[model samples]
Every structure is written in C-alpha cells, then in structure tokens.
Target: MQKLLEGLIKFREIDFEEHKELFGQLSKEQNPHTLFIGCSDSRLIPNLITQTLPGELFVVRNIANIVPPYHESEEYLSTTSSIEYAVNVLEIENIVVCGHSNCGGCKSLYASDEVLNEIPHTKKWLELAYEAKTKVLAEVSVEEVDKREWMTEQVNIVEQLKNLLTYPFIREKVSQGTLTIGGWYYLIETGEVFIYNKENGLFELAN
Candidate 1:
C-alpha cells in the first residue's frame, strides 16, 4: 500500500507534470490508435511493450487474452463490447491479440479436471481457448512440456484472431482493408515479441 501510494505521488509529480498537456487534452476525449487485446498477466505491460503513451492504445485484457466468437444472446460481454466500441465507435484501425510465454491461463488448458474444478469460472472461461489445446496436442506430445507450452500460447493467439473475425463488423472491415488484425507472442523472460505472419503462417521475431 505504501509503495503504491508513493508510486502514485511519483506519477503525479513527475510523469503527470511531464505529460500535463496530453492528459488535459485526453481528459475530454481519447483517440487511441490501436485496440490491443492482451492477457491479464501482471508482467505483460501492453503500453510498455508497445512503447505507447496513455491515450495511444485502447487495451482489453482478460485471462489468456481470449476473444469469444461474436454472439448476441443476453450475457454481460465486456471484452466483446469493448472490441465493438473500439471498431464501430472509435473507428480504430488496428487490432492486436497478444499471448505471452509462461501464461497460467494457457497452461490451464492442459490442467486436470481436479485442478480446474477448483476454479470453475476460469475453467468455463478457458473453453474459448480449448481449440488451441487441441491443435497443440495434435502437433506435440504433452510430455514435451516446453514444446507444448510454446504451441499452446502461440496457437491461442491464432485462435483469438479467428474469433475476432466472427464479428460481422470486424470481418467486413478486414475484408475491405480498413481494419487490420495482428497476433503477437510475447516472451516475458527475454523481453522479445514475435509477430504472426499470415502469409507464411509463421511467427517471426518482431524486431
């Protein structure tokens, strides 16, 4: 608590003072450039990774960085609604779905029922990412822990990108070349990111 308080004071005294005008302008409205959908991992800082400032990236974070396929029944859809607003309302140009290394959410896809049952809601939420597990299992043996982890996290990014296209608006925009979608795999240990290239269907170093 004390650390957080001091951090807040530091932000106000240094960071805020340096960007006072930008914040004042942003107080009225935010015109973010990209819709960054990333995992709710404490180590995965989207702004820091992207080298973006406060009003630059409109971020939506959830466990595993999952994007549920477009649906319209009657449930509280936070991430979906945020994507809708970023595209339709904000008219944002880019959408990025980022998955990271050593993600607990991604690893949970391989968890035993006994383990997952302890966190029922998380189990349910991870259903959106089960397809990635299926792909990983088919490609690599579960006994190969490192290979399984890499495929699970990166394949999850591909799955979410596919999910994003399920939205009619997103699909139309993508087809018309107005809105672009990207998949990113972040390596927490090495501070590196890989970009998925749909052309060759490979994730290459973002550098």
Candidate 2:
C-alpha cells in the first residue's frame, strides 16, 4: 500500500508532469487508436509491452483475456459492452486480443472436474476455452504438465479471436476493411510477443 502511494506521488511529481500536455488533452476526452483486450494478470502490462502512452490504447481485461461470444439475451455483460463501445463509439481501428503464458485461468481449464466444481462461476466463464481445450487435447501430446500448459495458453488466444468475430459490429468493421483483429501471445519469461497469422495458421513473433 505504501509503495502504491509513493508511486502515485511520483506520477504526480514526475511522470504526470513529463506528459503534462498529453494529460491535459486527455482530460477533455480519449480517442485511442487500438482496443487492447488482455488478461487481468498483474504480470502482463499492456501499455508497457506495446510501448503506448496514455489515451492511446483503450483496454478491456478479463481472466485469460477471454472474449465471450455475442449474445443479446445475456444481461450485464461488461466486456461485450466495452467492445461495442470501442468499435462503434470510439472507432478504434485495431482490436488486439492478447493472451499470456503461465496463466492460472488457462491452467484451471485443464484441472479435474472436481477441482473446477469448487469455482462454479470460473468454470462457467472458462467454458469459452472448451474448443481450445478440445483442440489442445487432440493435437498436442502432453507428457509434461508444462508442455500442456504452453499449448493451452496458445490455443486460448486463437479461441478468443474467434469469439471476438462473433460480434456483429466487429464482423461489419472487418468486412468494411476498417478494422483489423489480432491475437497475441506474450511470453512472460522470454519477453517475446507472438502474433497469430490467420493465413498460415501459426503464431509468429511480432516484428
């Protein structure tokens, strides 16, 4: 808590002062260039990784960076609403769905049913990874737990990208050539970012 307070003080004293003009303009409104959807992990800092400044990237974060399929019947879906607003209102041209390695949410998906049952909401939320889990199970032979985890992490990014397209606004934007959707896997240990290439059906390090 003290560290956070000191950081806040530093932000006001140095960081905020350094970008005073940017902060001043941001006080009026924000027109971000990209909508960054990433995992709600303390280790994964989207702005730091992307090297973006304030008001540049609109962000939506959740466990495992999951983007649920569009559903009108579902009430109080904040993630979906944020996506809609970013595209329709903010007019962000790029939407990035970023997943990271060593994700607990991805690990939980592979846990036994008994363990999963303890966290009912989490179990339901992670159902978005069902197809990814199935694909990993079928394609990847996992003799080691770490290998299985790595596969799951990669597959989850692919799955969420598919889920993002389910939104009508997203589909429309893509069709109009006004928006580009990207799936990213951030390797925490290696400090490397891999982007999914749809044409090749593989993830390559982002240049």
Candidate 3:
C-alpha cells in the first residue's frame, strides 16, 4: 500500500506533470480507438506493451482474458457492458484479446475438482475456457500436461475472439468492416508477442 501511495505521488509529481497537456486534454473526454481485453496478470501491461498513450486503448482485464458468450437475457455484466460501451458508444474500431504465458487462470483449468473446490467462484468463472480445454484434449492425451496447458492458453484466446462475435452490435460492425478483432499471445520471460494469423491459422511472432 505504501509503495502504491508513493507511486501515486510520483505520478502526480513527475509523470503527470510531464504529460500535463496530454492529460489535460484527456481530462475532458476519452476517445480510445481500441478495446484491449487482456489478463488480470500484473506482468501484462497493455499500454506499455503496445507503447500507447492515455486515451488510446480502453482496457478490460479479466481472468484468462475470457469473453463470455453473449446472451440477450443476461444483464449487468462488467465485461459485456464495457465491451458494448467501447463498440457502440465509443465506436472503437479495433479489439485485441491478449493471453499471456504461465497464466494462473489457464493452469487452473487443469486442476482437479477437489483442488478447484477450494476456490468456488474462480472455478465457476474458468468454465468459460472449458471449450478450449476440451478441444485440446480431443486431439491430445492427459499424459502431455505441459502441451495441453500451452494449447489451452492459445485456444482460449481464439475462443474469446469467437465469443466476442456473439454480440449483435459487434457482429454488425465487423460485418460492415468497421470493426476488427485480433488475438495475441505474449511470452512473459522473452517479452515477445505472437498474433493469430487467420490466413495461416497459426500464431506468428509480431513483426
């Protein structure tokens, strides 16, 4: 807490002062162009990784960067609401769903029921990635846990991207070519990003 307080003071004293003009303009309104959906991992900083400034990327961080399939009857969801605001209200054109290496949420998907019972809510939420896990398992056996986990993380990103399309407005914009979606995988130790290439159906290192 002390460290965060000190950092807040420093932000006001130095960083904020240095970017006073930019912050002043942003204080009026934010018109971010991209909606960045990333993991709630502290190591993954969306703006820092993309080298974007304030008011550039509207971010939504959640466990495993999951995007629940859109349902018309569902109401008052933080992720779904924010995504609607970003697309319909803010008119954001680009959306990036980023997944990182060594994610706790992804690893938890492989946890036994007894272990998952320790964290009920977390276990329930991770059900969003079950499809990804199932897809991986259909092709590979449990003996290869490491490969399964890695494939789960990658498949989860693409699965989330697919879920994003379940929203009517988002689908409309995408169909009209006004909005675009992207899936990204970040390697924490190497500081490298891989983007999903739809043409090749593979993740390739970002150029």
Indicate which candidate wins on TM-score. Answer: 1
Model 1 stretches astray by more than 4 angstroms: none
CA lDDT of every candidate: 0.95, 0.91, 0.94
TM-score, every prediction: 0.98, 0.96, 0.97
Check candidate 2 and list the clashing pairs.
none
In the range 1-207, model 1's lDDT, one tens digit per residue, is 999999999999999999999999999999998999999999999999989999999999999999999999688999999999999999999999999999999999989999999999999999998899998899889899998998899999999999999999999999999999999999999999999999998999986
Error of 2 at 56 (Å): 0.6
What TM-score does model 2 achieve against the real structure?
Answer: 0.96
Candidate order (lDDT): 1, 3, 2
Let me know the TM-score candidate 3 reaches against the reference structure.
0.97
The digit string of per-residue lDDT tens for model 2 on 125-150 reads 99988888888889766566787898
Best by lDDT: 1
Better of 1 and 2 by lDDT: 1
lDDT of 1 at 197: 99
**What total of clashing residue pairs does each candidate reach?**
0, 0, 0
TM-score-better candidate, 2 vs 3:
3
Q: Give the range of the ten consecutive residues with the poorest summed lDDT in model 2.
A: 139-148
Residue 87 displacement in candidate 1 (angstroms): 0.6
